[model samples]
Target: MTLSVQLRHGGPPLDFAADFPDGRITALVGPSGSGKTSILRAIAGLLPVRQAHVALGTEIWAEGNIHRPTRERSIGFVSQHYGLFPHLTVQANVETALIHLPIGERRKRALHCLALAHVEGLERRYPDELSGGQKQRVALARAIARQPQVLLLDEPFSAVDRSTRKRLYIELLRLHEQLAATVLLVTHDLDEAAQLASHLLLLRHGRIVQSGATSEVLTRPTSEEAARLLDIPNIFTARVDGTASGRNLRLRWGPHALRATGPLPAGIEGDLRWAILPSNVLLVRPDKPWGSHLENPLLVIVEEVIEMGTEAVVRLQPQGLSEARLQMRLPVRAVHRYGIAVGREVTVSLRAGDIVPLHTGPAR
Candidate 1:
């Protein structure tokens, strides 16, 4: 069943409407105080909003004067902290969600859920006795114990270590396949959202900046704000210099001229913001001669190289454009092989198709 939500609230004012597809994972991603959690709360009937119209298919959860109670809604919520009861055993915690079932059936269902969550042997242990990952698993068992129609997860893996988080990601995928429940996940990590969610909603200041298929929103953000929120670091101001060959549009950035694949935004005659993904910024290798087929090649001076284990984030300033710096990620081995360091001049290429024209005029 499709989960539809229309909410408007005061205080920090939130206003948005969206329809989450049935049996698909939709991620709500944004910075803090962006109403990711508020949307979840509003759906679960935990938040008192000024106006709300929430429904699963034709069954109304909240509309007009009617508001369904949290427990009545067929949703399972896992909070950032897991929300497992410290005093209860894992089995009892999960059993709490199955209370609507007969007394004898609850235990069996809860145990099955624990097994599905891959925490079968830990049923007797209390939440305090379990590790962070274990607690998260137990929480998942509890959430799915009643076989809810919608799963609401708020930073469910935030407390775990990287390796554990990865394992939990696999487990979540496994459970998702088995349960096939609609999931609304709230996360600050874009990578996590990209990995798990098919649809993504980018929120900022209680408003949805963009919402679309995960890959589309990540690659082709509708606005400069959305690009910035998604952490695309290669944003710069450029003026439309009219059309290039074929479908490419000419752009002038300071003294440098660039080309982007586009029918430029309608009636945009002047300066506009443009951004490219860091992954699209390629560093030309010295051993392998730069290809002539490459698009925008600019000589840049390496200003910073941040080593991130296997990969490095290199910031480069275009030779003559002191005001602009481009960020790109390269393999650590490539960084060492190229001897990429501060003050080193190197060439980087930006493909025409990779350059995305954003909002018109300078950012506010």
Candidate 2:
């Protein structure tokens, strides 16, 4: 199924086309108001668009003048808030989706779905009586009771605790494999998207900035907006002082010089935006000399270290330069072994290959 959308409702229009492979999970990821949920709603026909087209293997659910209602579209939508009725038990909620069937068939279908969602034992419990994860399971089970061709999940795990959410991720993956329904998940959590989605769509301000395989999109963001939204912190605006047919240009950031690779327009000079992931920031051994001794190594003062489980986010202030504060994500084991702490001087390296040029500006 390929979902092509162009929508406008007195706001910035959304105009982007993407294909959701049949029976595969595709995540719509972006910051709030980026139209992630709107896109899902549009697909479900709950939110009509000025111009939209949805096709599932040659069957058009929606198109110009041929719009299908939400129920007719046959999409199972699980909202972020877990729209489970407080008064209804888990079994009743699942059975509600199958009301069109006979009473006996509804009970059978609900039980099947509950088992598939791994919440079979909680069938008699009300929404309030269940844990956050259990409530989500009931919601998912209810959504799938209809056996819809497409499943739309709008941040279904966002409300749960981290540990609970992790468990749900595995459960969802299991259910996805068992059900084999095409899924479109709306979420702002990139890690969640990367973990569960085989494909990714990057949305921004009602536009599809990029879409591709999960690994490819994360490793190679197409623009500054994409990189920034991905939470990549090592972005910089460097003046291009030299170039060789737009390959390996010499760039200057503050008083520091660095090398950049990739094709740019010939004679492309002046300031250009570049970014690198914090994980790529390497620490130079103290035994080695800094400066001209290494290609991109720079002496920096450790301003702060934020412990994050097994890894730490270390803020490095480059010495003898006016560059912005840089952050490096290093293993806690390495940090402790090297006795790295606040105010300690250390050498850090950013490989030229790691520094990616953005298709956007240098916002000087």
Candidate 3:
């Protein structure tokens, strides 16, 4: 089924268009207060649509008299806090939505959901007694017990620790595939959006500024406004160098010169800013292939290296007077094995294929 939702209370408006394509996870990604939650409420009939319409398949929830109440809509929503009842047992919370069902069926369905959520043994546990991850799983169990036609998640892993959050993300993806659930998940996390969604929608100021295939939106976003919202680091200013209908730009960051694939707008050639990602940069021996889309190559000095468990973030201070600091994530092992320390020189290649030109600003 396809869902198109548009809503605005005051100030700016928010719009989202995408299909709940069968057996795929579609994510609604943006910064905080960007109308992600409002979209959820509007779709569930819990919020009023000011000047927009919401359509789910042939049913129009925000148009005409076709509105379906939250209880009537077959949607299972899981919020960031995992709103499980404090006084209720795990099984009770999971089975709460199934109140209309007979006792036997309700218990059966609840247990099945708990098993899928990997909370089977915690059936007798209370919300307060459960860990953050466990509570979220129970919240998911409750959602799936409703046998919802659509699943809506709102930053479900945000409250947990980094380790638990990663595990939960994997589990969520597995569950989505196992059930073939149509999902519309809301997150302020870029990594979550990149890893979880097949399609991405970047919202800002309550408007859906950009939406497309995850890579397309991330790399070649539609607007400067949308680029700022993606939190893309190291976006540089540059101009088109060659004649591909201005479909190329010569960007200069600090003393580093780079090339971009898209046509630079008029007056932006050599005088405008370009966008690059720290993570997109490759730090290695200068002899290694610089991938396919090669751009500016820099022999940078490792100014600082932060060992962040699984990954090490290396800060590179490029040559010359350009006051730009380039950062790249390398595995912990790579940092340790290379004896890559502060003041060590490394050749970092900022390839064109890795370039995502988003005007001249970082993604918010």
Candidate 4:
């Protein structure tokens, strides 16, 4: 399956394009009003595209002049609210979509779909009688009753509680394993996208900011905007001052100078930005003797500590720097072990390999 779309509309332009393979989930994620849902609507034929090309498994679903209607696209779409008929029972809601088949066949298929959705016992319950999770499952069963070639989900689990959402995530994964349909999910939660999707398309201002495998995009973003959008911690602006020992490069940031392991890129000089994840920041004790360390240890004042079960986020500010702060996620036990708290002095080290150079530009 391949989807190539280019849309130009009023306000921020949607110059978005990407290709999704068969039987894999591609998540469309970004901030609110970033056109993530707009792209999904266009793919489902709910919105018109000024210029586009879309295909699914050797069939021409849409092109510049020839556009297929929503029904003809043979896609199953689940909206945020789990759009179900309040008057119809769970069984009847699913059976309605299978009305094209014979009467007995329709009943059999509807029952089978209910079984697949784990809602077989609640077939006679109406939409208002079922819980949020059950209603979502019923809606899903109805959408998949006809066996669509593609499935589009726009924050389908947002209406449910957190625990219910996690359960639905596992259910969706099992359903995908059985059905093997090309799935496109839209969500504003990056953690949800990382947990559920195999590939990710980061959208911003109605355009695709980054697209790649979930692991790659989450770890190694290409630019500063991408890193910021990904919520990467400890982003500092620095300049490549000169070369260091054994092909290492030196960088100057604020009142501190640091060494980078790799050689500087050819023809690159002047100011640059570097980012390190919170998990990569190492903690050192100020009272400990200084060994032959590669980089200088930073003296910082602990500003805040937030405990969240297994881990704690320690916010620190460099002692003499005016506008520099670093965050580290340490184990909860370690926080107490080292006596980390507000207004305490501590030493921290950032390895050269953990720092990645980032380019800056308007995300598109």
Which candidate number has the best TM-score?
1
Better of 2 and 3 by lDDT: 2
Relative to the unseen true structure, what is the C-alpha lDDT of residue 199 in candidate 1, on a scale of 0 to 100?
97
Worst 10-residue stretch by lDDT in candidate 2? 3-12
How high is each candidate's TM-score? 0.95, 0.89, 0.82, 0.90
RMSD of every candidate to native, in Å, equals: 2.2, 3.1, 3.9, 2.7
* Candidate 2 colliding pairs: none
Query: What ordering of candidates by lDDT runs from best to worst?
Result: 1, 2, 4, 3
Give candidate 3's root-mean-square deviation (CA, Å).
Answer: 3.9
Per-residue lDDT tens digits of candidate 4, residues 254-274? Answer: 767787765344454788887
What is the C-alpha local distance difference test score of each model? 0.89, 0.84, 0.76, 0.83
**Candidate 1 per-residue lDDT over residues 1-364, each given as its tens digit:** 9999999888667987899989999999999999999999899999989999999999999999999999989999999999888888999999889878997899899899999999999998888889999999999989988789999999999999999999999999999999999999999999999999999999987878889899988998768888989888888888889875556788888778888995446555688788999889998887886566879888899999999989999999997888898999999999999899998999999888889888643122
lDDT of 1: 0.89
Model 4, position 115, has a per-residue lDDT of 90
* Top candidate when judged by lDDT against the true structure: 1
